[model samples]
Target chain A: MTESLQGARVVIGSIGDDIHVVGITILGHALRNAGAEVIQLGIQTPVEEFVATAVAEDADAVFVSSSNGHAAIFCDGVRGLMAAAGADDVLLYVGGNLANTAAADWSEVEARFLAMGFDRAYPSRTQPAQAISDLVADLAQRRSASNG
Target chain B: MADNVTNERLTDDAFHAQRETIFREQLGRAPYDLDEALAFSLENAKRGTVAAVLQKAKATGVAAVVPRAGVASWEGQRALMQMLDEAGAAYLPITIDSLTRELQFAEAERRLASSTTEVSALNGYPIVAHGIEANRRLIQSFDKPVIVRANAVDLRITAETGLASGGTAFVSGPMYATLEYSKNTPLSEGISKWQYIFRLMGIYSEAGVPMADDAVGFSQSGTCSVPALMHVGVILDALIMASQGVKHIMLYSMLQGNIAQDVASCLAVEQLATEYLHKLGLDDVSTYVASSDWNGAFPERRPDAYGLIAANVFAAAIARAPLNYVKTIDEGIGVPTAESNADSIRVTRYLMNLIGRQAHAWRTPEIEFELHLNLIQARAILDAIIDLGDGDPVVGSIKGIGTGILDIPFSPNIHVKGNVLPIRDASGAVRFLDHGALPIPAEALEMERERLSHRSADPSALGYQDVVDDLQFLELDTFDPATGTEVKA
Candidate 1:
């Protein structure tokens, strides 16, 4: 299962004023264990940084994480920026507390980010294994698509 | 290589020149003058400052209660302070907003003046946006001397604004600010920036102002079971400030749950800092200990939260910490309201009175062991750090932390992979399951393991979930003092 991401380059960070480091740091460690090259841009990252580093590192995916539900403030238009940087093939994923206090439904939060151009969105309380497995499958599918 | 930072004291010319930039360019106000500042300190000396209040608390043997407070509008902030003061706060805080802390004054100005809900509303008052005199008016409106609380990337400009606004003290020194507050900056740069901050405090001290500098672990590290090394951060914080000529040093330790260890952390910081400062030939500096109550999870119910507050108050009285940074019953929820903050102070005040009379049962072998253990853990690291910096804490911290000779990580708990925090031993006191990158002594490490082994009857078969139980330990521990076997309702 982990063979799909063997030596895959991934960029992960918590964007905006969200200084939630523990969750993302744990995710980075797990990704590293799964044979992925994880470039950690810790907390309070801007959108341009996620794009610039992904482009510079030639990363296969960019994972934007936030626990503050201020995603609408920072995560909006982020994938478009990555696209503008001419890296549209690079997968964009965001997770963790994507909705404000009023958000009662996880599906609605996921759909909001998907509309904002994220390939997928995970809600709060997501285990590290779930996100890792999704990334592994997504990378495998992308590899087949490119080869075909 | 770190740029534009140094351990050298700023010359008079350099300080004056820096002030021009700090007030005018940074704050959009007239330059701050040494004469006016000196005169202001002299003027305010009779009225009493935070240091004076703490000094009096020391003299009277009272553990004074203080609260953290700020809001967007001056009227709103003044009213909050007024309510807290009337509710019995010993000293107040001018908690600066996030934008001001990050040096985003223009944005803060726009947000403060803009009648729109356009940008996210700032979390606290904008001291710089309100300007010096405006802040002075709000501060002087209250009776007690205020402390400027901020987690700025560089506190030099913020300190200047805060001092000019009649704050008798500035909280969060270099080591505390950098490791705890800053996300990506190097330690040396924080050292360099805080050099200016201490020089500013030195300036006030030279002018006969009783200016105090506080060194608390600025990190949410207080939210978890902070290692014994957290006290080292406190001592090193004071060393960095004292080296820069700061006179009065205030050391803050957070309570991480265990009553004995929690109290020991504060005592260890005071005793160790005094000894080390004396070793450095800076013995004139007086050290005071202050303890902040739990920064961790609180039960959602207000009554339950009050029980937790009462437990911490008992801890403070036991430790005899001269000042206690109190927490509201709204800890498990969002930012506390003025009424809630006042309620916390009243509860703390009442408990201090009740607990002050009954404390003969507290001085036990457990407390002595915890205190001795705390000193041992902190000294081993400090000796290595000072030797690494060639006897200068300011230089040592920059070089030592940068080199990992002082192996505190981006998070203070450097050993925590996957963000797993330090877990507890059998007695519910947090002991490191893995020492990680911390340089705690070998015997202490053995003692910790031996203690932690008690959590399982068959110590060898302890499961992963057993260790992880500490995360939710406090949830059921609401009104922790009431957990005594005989005290159940």
Candidate 2:
């Protein structure tokens, strides 16, 4: 079966202070092939810009990934801003090399993100396709609800 | 030619046997994937080999080490020089590219004069063979002996082109691994490239020279603790090898902070790593701080005190590993400009040359403890072998020799490490020395900003910026468990 995400408008970028772009680039390509309109904000992006762009562009979803283990700090203002902009309907996701077993617990990190109202929190070394599929399903549900 | 040299001056087999013993003694085993394509250099006499090569380089005046691969750090270069220095030898650091490119080498020198580390342009994949012929021409124009370092292919080119022109050619290491690790498809295809290139150059070697491969594979033991443990492993291996009779072993270790944010995390990791190496037997291992001062591309996280901690930790490494050499910082950044590069060299040079002039000082109690722990660990791991039939140091497997834990890579704030980094006027000293490249030319920096700007989804857009702002709040200081609000530092 073909992985056709043709009609999804996805806004992809790094949130907060992360400079890693390799994972984001690969994800963009995968999403694009699946038929999503992928907008890539390379690095060092502010959350205000991410939300505004998604709202103005009427994007179906906004995805941000951070490899630096500060995702707790990275995902903070983003959730609130999305709600303020009425883009709360947009599916937001985050991932990267955030925390290891040595320092912080991954479960606590996941809980913190859930509290902040993120739709999904991807653990480190996650499969890129899994993230895209979840975002696609969320967006599809939103589309059907809006039309109904 | 081989027969003439063998009958008159050197006998290859005897030399090989002696060198092999040294290798076994120093590395605790025969070289892995040992190929006749490269000949191994004996331990203590490696400096003799370097001195001889440098002297030959001086005599030839047009000597060039092509695609000067393998050893990429200034410490790599310095380790070679220290070997030469031990033998009372000297070689010029003149490079044709330094003159031709807009790269800042003058600043690198100034940085070297101070005590800061400078990044060498030889970071990833060795120096590319960008301008070999012209460099050769430049060397030829000089009236002094020049040693050109080249891999097997470059050696062939140098030989074929200068064939009756008369110049000494000593093949530097890089060929074997280069052929082994190319990103090209089909292993045979890579081999074919090496084969064809060597064929064109007309220089083929059944045996190649061996060089030390120093690496600190990634680990996730929180902070620089992972590197610290790995350093212990390297030192133990070297000491065991030395006990076996190897006279020379080049050790290189860098604090891998590519995934860390803030200079502190980097420094913490480096400090632990340096301490471990010092405790081990490698007193002369060179230290290079690969400082990016930011955790892998993310900003919500503050800059860890990598630079601050690295300077202190490296100082400790120098004090501990008197035998190990230390390069400057800026190793992970762009090719260090001249000012930065010089500061690196000068910093290491002063540490080794002046203050380090006195007999090497090692923390005795620590080394004793470290050695004791290493022995205990080694015995436990090798109990299986010791339990088996006859056992010998020479026969110890690489795994049986050390703790044998290949470090695990993890994503976490490396700064959570507990080491205290000392503060010094490191950058201030480098600045006073006036040895840093002017932050990339304004125009060039601007051009890059513009390039990345093209990838920007929103400039003044608030939605994206808001998400980013919230993330920053999470790390503004610390998350207060009581209130859940960001704490101020």
Give the alpha carbon lDDT tens digit for every residue of B1-489 in model 1: 245444556788877776677667666777666678678767866678888888888788777899887776777787888898899999888777666777878877776775232223455788877877889788788778899887655877778878877899888876666676557667776776777788888988887887898877432453455445676778777877887788887787777667778767767778888889898888989878878878755565687788778877887777778888887886655456788899999999888777766766777889888888778877887888787667766667666655565654336222222222366666667665544545678888777767766775544455444443444455455235675422111
Query: What value does DockQ give for candidate 1?
Result: 0.15
Cα deviation of B381 in candidate 2 (Å)?
A: 4.5
Backbone clashes in model 1, listed as residue pairs: none
Q: Native contacts recovered by candidate 1, as a share?
A: 0.05
In candidate 2, position B449 carries an lDDT of 36
Q: Which candidate is the best by DockQ?
A: 1
* TM-scores, all models, native as reference: 0.81, 0.33
lDDT score at residue B26, model 1, on the 0-100 scale: 65
User: How would you class the docking of model 1?
Assistant: incorrect
Positional deviation of B212 in candidate 2, in angstroms?
A: 6.3
Largest TM-score belongs to which candidate? 1
Model 1 C-alpha lDDT per residue in residues A1-148, reported as the tens digit of each score: 3444687999999887666665676678778878889999887888899999999999998999976435776888798898899999998889866754321466776788899999989865465678788888898899798899
